[model samples]
Target: MKRKNILLGAFALLLVLGFGSCQKSDLPLDGTVSKERIAALQSNLKKALHDTTQGWVMMVQGLNANVRTAMPVLLKFDTLTGDVTTRTLFSKDKQSSKFVLSASTGVPLLSFSTFSYISQTYTAANTAITDFFFKVLDVTADSITIQPFRKGNIYQSEGGAIMKLFRASSDKMKWALDLLNAPGNTGNIFTQTSLFGRDLEVRLKASFATDSIRSRTGFYSWGGSLNVVKSNTPITRTYPTLNPIVIEFYTTFPIPANAVPLDVNTVVGDGLIYWQPTTALTPADYFLNGPNATINFLKTDYLLIKSMTANSVEVYAVDASGNVCITGRIGD
Candidate 1:
């Protein structure tokens, strides 16, 4: 009788253990639901960036310390790959780069592996800042709202520096390009003057000057044709296409009164040199070289329009590293 009782007890314990094992295996506690959600969000993000008829624009503030509230950036995402192209006042040309889409701690985030035009400026300005990853907070048909991932950066700890991406059309894209390209008072090629007459005053803020001149200094202008002036020496370059505008000193002509000669020789001028618009080159490349290439103003990669009028314009130059190398006013 005792042996039979022991056998029954052993069988009952085995059955209980089997049931417990089965229950654990069948429990709904796996991360399947969260994983599905993350996948769905990633798909949605890819579609949002690439499926639309046009690109997207985001007004990013807090990226630069010197500027105002924000700067606008345009981005186009590739439909077939993780490639991205960006247009900004940071450069005269468009930038092509790639980004990464990653899932972290049950959230989807986007980051740039290569330095896009926008990232170049942002990271260059803030040395301690590294990540450009934006946490996907929300998305809509026309907009995506994102905040920087909490990675011990300014946007994460200080908070409220959220970036908003909005849909942009083809026409909007063209307009943005045009705005960044325009460099003269007229802001177009057709409006360049025959001679940058005495009316052609320059407010130079070149890299070497003691202080940026507020008052417009008188200068002369002639089209591509060479014209000798009595006292004022205007930078002689092809107007409406000031591509090869020369900043060399003219022994025959003196610089405007109280005006410092705008030369690469005087400053650490290895960047963008200022020039007005021209017909042959709507957006032209300019070089500021000193005697025998001793000084090279090769750092200027950007021309930004600050303000404009019928006869007057305000502009500045920024290098690839987000340094505003020069700012000046032009006009009557």
Candidate 2:
């Protein structure tokens, strides 16, 4: 009886040990994530965005000729606990662009662009800030399909560039993931501008209205041919005619309280310009003289001259070399 009891106890102990081993095997083991790995991933993502030779450089180069003409002033990046932020400043307009990313997923989450430019002595302010929430819709060992929740606003110029960057970067990302084995073609042309610019151009089509010319308006009208000169010689000449009139009118009447002056310099320098309203003027109160010509104004205590009686006006012309010459200002 004693030997049988001993045998039973030994069998029970063996069964307990076997069950414990099975339970331990069924539990999942922790896959540890190290700080060093996270840091390396962040670095790689930053390099991909700002890489001049291979990455976003191509996308940035495709910005409108005017925007690209201005050089960048500063480009900086900062690493946080699990994210990275990059900032850039442009030289011409002191414009800035910022980008933020997640370290773990190597995904971009936010982007912002801001700038102020002077046109015809008036200041124009522009800002665009966008947020992107990247959700992994599908993932495999070699590829990922992500749905981006994009929310933000942008000025016309920077908006176009941002759209282009997104499209180009998406294509590049796929190529990078494929180890460059994929073809270099993105279905869309890299040279095309955003749809927004195209829509704006269409909306601003030329129109005409006829009414009796108001007297004592204190209007100053200037018109000149736009001639592209290379090596001090005219390459292309765009003549000004009476059909499409470009004029600048100044008035101190009870203009709307929300009137804002357009930046004349930015308009003439760049093809398009935008302005915000102050108590003096609103953007809506301003009108373009011609479809091709952009108009902007400055705030002055008073209009220098109130009225003109002549059928025609005479104005001084400054040549490209800064030589002042007298030109006959013809009226329509």
Candidate 3:
């Protein structure tokens, strides 16, 4: 009887152990985010926007290098009226429009629901254009980071100047249409860049539209030594225009205008020429033009500038893996 009791007790203990092991380690306590919790978050976001005085200041980078450079924009949100007052370097007057906050796949989106100056503008081809919804990526005390988002999370990656916003203060707002118009104040001519320790020529036009091709010759921010004369022989571009081609993947999504006004470089050291084409052509001597003047081929390059002053700008050009491919100065 004692032996039988010992075996039964051991089996019972085994059963207890098995049941304890099966008790589902409590599923990691990531915390169950209920519907109420999401609503609370959305409400808090709106509160932050409404509490600000000067609203928000953002240097908005447009859809696929449209502005020739990042354009400063101000958005003053009135949550009570579901309205947002918008301003930009492109327009002097404040334009009011409707805005809505909603959630998609657990992420909140701030969308311009009506025509606003920042959203609605004249295209380079002189047609109507609109900049659509923004995904609220993060919110801090003084700033908000947003991503230009299309429906279904397409091209949903975060990048460029449009990603950040600062609560605009009286002291921080320092841009106007007139301030951007003066070329001597807006940008400096940068003609010398380096790649692989070799210096390259790069002269920026006072205005790409009216200048002769020779005046704007030399290489792009992403070029190499000699790299050959940036143009092939027998080519000439008397008048040039930076054209913005639409990325067709954004179906049903409102896109920004393809307008690069003559004085679009509001910031001195921040311009990326993703797609630029002259009226005719420039120097006639490059086998690989990256993407600047190439026809139909799509390879992207940018001008990463820093430490800009009245005389010089530290130019940076990176390779595919983010390694510094080109480094030098373009200054007096």
lDDT of each: 0.49, 0.25, 0.43
Per-residue lDDT for 209-238 in model 3, tens only?
A: 343111111223333522222221101110
Residue 41 local lDDT, model 2: 49
Clashes of each: 17, 9, 7
Greater lDDT among 2 and 3 belongs to: 3
Best by lDDT: 1
Task: Kindly list the per-residue Cα lDDT of model 1 for residues 1-332, writing each as its tens digit.
Answer: 99999999999999999887774456458888888888888888888988876578775443323322234567888858778887654344566888888987576888766856545433322222234677776678877887655434455453235666877664434444445455534343123344233444555576645655443332333244323211111122111122233433321123456544432111111122332112222112212222112122222223355655667656665432234557776566
Relative to the unseen true structure, what is the C-alpha lDDT of residue 267 in candidate 3, on a scale of 0 to 100? 12
Worst 10 residues of 1 by lDDT: 229-238
Better of 1 and 3 by lDDT: 1
Could you give the candidate ranking by TM-score, starting with the highest? 1, 3, 2
- Ten contiguous residues with the weakest lDDT in model 2: 233-242
